[model samples]
Target: MTGHVRPYRSYVYAYPHKTAYRPLPEPGPALRDLWRDERKDALSLYLHIPFCEVRCGFCNLFTRIGAPDELTGRYLDALDRQATAVRDALGDTAPVRFANAAFGGGTPTFLEAAELERLCDIAEKRMGADLRAIPLSVEASPATATADRLAVLAERGTTRLSLGVQSFVDEEARAAVRPQRRADVDAALARIRDARIPVLNIDLIYGIDGQTPASWRTSLDAALAWQPEELYLYPLYVRPLTGLARRTAVTDRDWDEQRLSLYRQGRDHLLAHGYEQVSMRMFRRPGAPAQGPDDHACQTDGMIGLGCGARSYTSTLHYSFDYAVDMGHIRAIIDAYTGTEDFTRAVHGRYVDGDEARRRHLLQSLLQARGMPLADYRDRFGAEPYDDFPAELAAFAARGWLDDDAPDGLLRLSPEGLAHSDALGPELFSAEVRAAMAAYAVK
Candidate 1:
């Protein structure tokens, strides 16, 4: 008899909130001190642009809707001041040698051309000329992007753009509360291509309410017509406190199956069209490396996040500031920055404490389809996976969830493993590691 597949549920268990974790110790090591010790393989920078024309129903990122020009100006000033503070804190530390710099958003295009240039200028001054060769990636909503904006980005060294093109079907877009039109995406793509930026990524979402297999196919076809250099496909995740969570319920089993099937179909389609899976959910033109794959900066090393609601990680601790546009939080960050008190202490309480270096090494490696290198693991942590996680590694291998080999030894997740990656964290990691991760989940 064939096994019965369960229907897909729209709701998923929410990860733990960051507040539950303990705060870091006071007078901890300075930013420069930390960077000096980080593995110099590669470093990257993330600049958060927290302004948005409108917030999507499924988005839980830090942003404010209908932000006026004056507010953006104030935020830019704050960003500049913060960058200076970081520079001052680094004093005599080694300069940053970044492999890539990303401007993630709310919507990066929401910023005026001047504001974007100013931010890039700040980065260039601090990170130096080395960053010019690095891929500068920025995300934009198609409706908000313009030729002038694309030109400005290209002039400032932005080489790639990730366009949020969630769905081609108007009804599906409405259901997801994304107010972009198909025509806007087409025009924006043309403008971007014309700017001579070598890479363009289109982001598509599946499993949204009102989306059917046919609608998904149409979305894929529409995206293919543009021949974007890259594609990122993600399933709808109904995050808590989002508009969609309150207004709708996701309980369609067949719809869930259709969603996964569509992802597989999309992957195959892209591959046949000459795109390769550089990583899960990411596909790029054949022989063209996905932006920053060789550096492995995002997952391998902890990044310094400088913005409201951004999270930062170091070798020993994790810190995050809640720039949620919540008046209280904003006031707290401001007060902290102005020396009303230690704002870092007040706004960004410590979320996790442990061997963050080892944790990052393991998690990032496992997340990548190719897995982690055994030698790198031993070199960093002073022990092999088998020696450190003997029982867990053995059990995982027994279940065919991970491969056990040196240099090429990777903790790859089989289909069954991929289905349970979240759960496997607790099972594979040590109790200390699990506790550190759990601490970050506290509200």
Candidate 2:
């Protein structure tokens, strides 16, 4: 056994983070070539709004504080221009069928009610995506989940609304540097219910400084009061430039153990409340509708990401605008994105070779509650995942993290393995990718 101890938060194996991405030498032609023969049956659409009311202490996402009075309009104008160019670039690939759609980042609802409506128009009218025909998910914050915004979303076929309520206790929220009141969270929940969206997902955090088990339960129980369709319990992570990182003084191992304990408590609590464990962090009530098949399953299909922070995925490359954790750098990128007229090409991305593709498929599937199917792997790659990643799989099995002897021939994670998913994910990363990510400039 290696006896390594990782932070136990989510791992970085090619989703969300853009640290490994490099500038494409031939952006336009490269994208065209990548998408030339790509499947058009089903695709996922993502639109990012990189503006937020406040920057939380633990946030390392690509978002800036609330836009100035006229900035939102200018951003939207840029988005429209990019959408038109992207649609045009698709050429014959223009009318690809989209199975899922989402508006995320910072806060999609941070826009005014009218702006929200226009945002939907851009998705439908400009991008040629039929939001009404597919499941649509949008992210919001307690402070911004306003009545008018929710109404526009509901009318525009937003099936799910996810709210970031890191904690229900006002004191704990303050401790985490996430400014909000319990009353505001409750009010937002009520408004969401009133909007009659099919699903309501609540996001909570554990392992914050000065947080106790009692405090965690208080937050969890308060969230359960609404019987939310989905609940996500995230472990607090203090990255290099985040507010929490500047103030945090805890040892990594100690924090990891505390987070592990909290994760177990939260998982067991949700299971007792008739919620199914979708993964280490996600819980779903018994009768809640699934959040669309294509939402998280991007390995099999293509994705078109529409704003500055969003990343578009082809079969072999994932591309996005420049990525940064510092506010100044993020602003610079957003400013550059707003002025750009050409959306026909990819500027920054990482290429996925055959080996990398296999690794992605394995990582994405194995990390979920559903194990990776041996037959499916063989069908896709003409060889079992075990054949390609024998050492990694064997090591996990030896560590009691995998069910190597499952009768179904599926590679599944044991409970202990699930608990150590963060560690496992990085171990699967290619050395080259890891070095590239490590060398990335944080600011």
TM-score of each: 0.83, 0.96
Could you give the C-alpha RMSD of every candidate to the true structure, in order shown? 4.4, 1.8
lDDT of 2 by residue, 97-159 (tens): 778889998899989999988889999998778888899999999999989899999999999
The true-structure Cα RMSD of candidate 2 reads 1.8
| Cα-lDDT of candidate 2 | 0.84
TM-score of model 2 (CA atoms): 0.96
lDDT of 1 at 289: 40
Encode model 1's per-residue lDDT on 39-118: one tens digit a residue. Answer: 53455677787768887988876666755537666666666666665555444545445667788868889887888887
Q: Candidate 1's C-alpha lDDT? A: 0.64
Model 2, residue 283: distance off in Å is 1.1
Candidate models: Cα lDDT each: 0.64, 0.84
User: After superposition, which runs of candidate 2 have C-alpha atoms over 4 Å from their true positions?
Assistant: 1-4, 7-10, 13-17, 26-30, 93-95, 294-300, 404-407
Error of 2 at 331 (Å): 1.0
Q: Which 10-residue window of candidate 2 scores lowest in summed lDDT? A: 292-301
